[model samples]
Target: MNCLLFTWRKGDGKLKIHEVRKQLTTPLGAPAYPWGPYNFRNREYLNILYRTDMEALRRVVPEPLAIDEPLVKFEVMYMPDAPGLGAYTEAGQVIPVSFNGEKGEYLHAMYVDNHPAIAVGREVSAYPKKLGAPRLYIDSDTLVGTLDYGSLRVATATMGYKHQPMDLALARQELSQPTFMLKIVPNTDGSQKVCQLMRTQINNPTIHGAWTAPARLQLFAHALAPMADLPVLEVISASHIITDLTLSKPDVIYDYLAEH
Candidate 1:
């Protein structure tokens, strides 16, 4: 399990890379092994990659006792609201996004894993700590939801898991992780309530290899009492995996799976 860190600075447009090393040990007095020397530049990118690995561990691990090797890559794009968070520009690199929302800036982190974690019970300890709760909406069998961060809305959708077909396995898997939890919170305006919490293990291979479990929308009112009177608009979080890019070469993936 190698982890790469990609750091983005908004001012000068620079991307720095760093490698993180972790020791995986067994009970015996001998050396268990060294998992990484992963490359990355910052913490936000690390968080995104960590979440991806956590999801893979939960949904795709067919066996419990096996050890899997996954090659991972990450990219972080930061649109800073204020200075001093290490937002500096570099020569030749262009800023990937603009600051259009009220928040004034946004941070978008993208993670790509070539060989991701595929262990059933073996947990990846690198999951994110600041993920917001998902708001879930279902129309017939389709699953749709939004993740609200103050005034910002992150939208997500899930068709279902492969084995279960129509079942929302990704949502269930996310709800099942001990580290991940969901709760209803009032929105900034007292008018409504929204879901608040973080999620883990929400990926399924059957449906585009992407899935999201949203929090309940009504809870926003109760969670943020002071803002109950404010107008609420539906917003969507744009987090999703392009399966063709992420899960290409099924034969190769299966071959790697078989080797493990």
Candidate 2:
């Protein structure tokens, strides 16, 4: 199959072959998203790691990626100075898994409040990102993170703000690992045209401030955003971090379905 791109004329609405093969992204004249690698500064995070059931972990993590542990990382990010994506808040769930003996996190579900952020994330890197309401802020001495899909609450997390300085070196190492996700692009016939596992990681992250704290996480069942599908049995660890980093595109690791 061949890939073709075209646009419409201004007045008569005639089809114009204005395709630039190597040009960043699609829809020609007015691209909705900016081309990366995007830079971010003062990116704040409220990460709460929790334990879950092994059966639940196995159901979400795909094959070729083994479940390293029955653990899930519930994270809420506040991007204050993201260059291309603008300032937005995002929250998601990630699972600990290993691909071909390499340990990494599998991005299960993510929601952002920014339009461009959601567009770029889903189209560019194929990150499982959606447009949902997520917020991160400080309330009194607690760092709060909440996610909502429409009018229903999906998740809520709270931590003691700057309770104790975290191990920066360890935090940096953990953040450097590649994350795996599946990309599905459907064809006109309702068949999957592109189905593959993609790998992406933070390019270079500079941790400005990091801390560990006592935290709690509450996940509610939702129809659209089913984050609570992976139940939180116990909260393991929590971290609040401020960092600067760059976002890079993902590389296709494994093809799940091929057009024959």
Candidate 3:
């Protein structure tokens, strides 16, 4: 699966273009910083693109096989930091995302399988203390769908940090809070067939080292949607359980790692 993660800081006032540029140019442990084009003069925003693989993804993801699509994408927007309540604003907003470097003003919608009692436990889970939990617009088991104009669907997923730990304390913290994992399946050809999969993260307070989930089931749906005459594949969501904890040192570090 080829996935792209895009992050945007609240450019309102705290994060200027220069600071963003410096952060990108001088990331904590990287010897050489990665830089990209940002309309700094206009103070638009900065974007960093990461081409990663499965082994790297498994470090943070609890369920990798559940996501089997080829193109996964996500967008993070910096919420306007309001005094006292600023951090809460960005808690559960689904910022638009472009996949495969495609961008434009497009229509987009979301469908969430609604389930009851799912929100009760998510309230304080690692989410920003100020923003609180999302509004619980729909149930997880209930199928709520939307129509949009974008070429791709960016989906996001959240595993209970307390339930599943991903080395990073912040991720664990956010997991402590109520977070939603998204699965975006593009709708084309006027059929309910999902074209591609897009993944993303939502309601995270801190901004660094964030990752996006893969769109595996969405891709499978798209492939199978066309052949309605064939037996439809069943996709199920299981608990976020992590097992087999082990650490092994690599024999050698390659100068460059290629994407599959």
Give the winner by TM-score.
2
- TM-scores of the candidates are 0.20, 0.91, 0.19
TM-score winner between 1 and 3, please give it. 1
Q: For candidate 3, what is the lDDT?
A: 0.23
Off by over 4 Å in 1: 1-96, 99-105, 108-142, 146-260
Error of 1 at 135 (Å): 6.8
CA deviation > 4 Å runs, candidate 2: 1-27, 258-260
Q: Is candidate 1 or candidate 2 better by TM-score?
A: 2
Q: Give a tens-digit lDDT track for model 2, residues 1-260.
A: 43433444566655444535555676677677878778899999899999999998888888888997789999999999987778899999989888999889999999999988888888777889988999998899999999999888899999999989999997897788889998888999999889899998985699999999999999999878988889999999999989999876789999988533
Q: What lDDT does the true structure give each of the candidates?
A: 0.25, 0.88, 0.23
| TM-score of candidate 1 to 2 decimals | 0.20
Judging by TM-score, tell me the better candidate of 2 and 3.
2
lDDT of 1 at 20: 20
Candidate 2 local distance difference test against the native: 0.88
For model 3, what is the error of residue 153's alpha carbon versus the real structure, in angstroms, after optimal superposition? 31
Scored against the true structure, residue 13 in model 2 reaches a CA lDDT of 57
Clashing pairs in 2: none
Ranking by TM-score: 2, 1, 3
